[model samples]
Target: MFIFQAAAPGTSIIRRDLGAEPLPQTEALYAVALASPATLAAPPMGSLNLSEALIREVEAADVIVIGTPMHNLTIPSVLKAWIDQILRVGRTMKSTPSGKVGMLRDRPVYIGVASGGFFTGERANQPDFLTPYLSLALSSIGLKTQQFLTLQGPPHWIGARHR
Candidate 1:
């Protein structure tokens, strides 16, 4: 699985625990995958146009995992930047005369969210942009995403256990 951790320092800790290598941010990664022979072989995909470099990463991996610490009620800009790259038109996805068609086959995406407060429903303790937006956006592009595995510290979610 390719882990896209929005938190850098904490992300390294998580990566070490999981025994997985984190993928580089999209730009540096772009050139490696877009090498001459590979691009030449696949004309249907013109991923060179995307500067965000996320498309190459996503296409290369069979599974994707995202680790994030909720900040100010939203996802970090770094992760959002990656999303911008992968959601390219006529590349990872396309709009056609018929309708929107996702070129990517279905892949599983696991989201690891660490938050100080609870925000599962309408009665949100804090504004949350992680769960819903991630679910929707990933679904839009043929990724099967799941609700977060929320690791809430002792202050919250410690007393309750859901079935």
Candidate 2:
């Protein structure tokens, strides 16, 4: 896989399997809203909270690599939940008079996508909401530099017919 190939001498890799791990709960949004001010003022340390854990991961990473399959033209709900947990106001971004501004320093993000059906160029029949949405989300968190690699074909041709 891409991660394995990307791994080399002096490179550190941190992997989070969203499907296997217990994602943040819906209540996490409320918790963030309540803790935003305090967190912004003095960031927590040694916290075991899931949201905090995810935030720390993003903060520590130099380059983020995500590999995912297209599901109904968008990312899975679990990934969306992870996004909600990480995109904390005052922590990842701030609301200014002009608009929301990202606080974290920009970094490069590489997204590998696999699709059963074509979603790019003139042959595309399905609308691609994933790329644009993810771009905006990452940018909101100050990760503006992004590279996307996609493999598109028929379900059977791509050996994804089981899905």
Candidate of highest TM-score? 2
Task: Give the Å error, residue 56, model 2.
Answer: 0.9
Model 1 regions more than 4 Å off: 1-53, 96-100, 121-123, 145-147, 153-163
lDDT score, candidate 2:
0.78
* Clashes by residue pair, model 1: none
How well does each candidate superpose onto the true structure, as a TM-score? 0.59, 0.80
lDDT tens digits, residue span 1-163, model 1: 3223453333332222221333335564454444455553453344445543446667666556677867767776666766666765556666678755677778767788877766665345766677788776776677864546776443555666221
Question: What's the alpha carbon RMSD for model 1?
Answer: 9.0
Predictions in order: lDDT: 0.60, 0.78
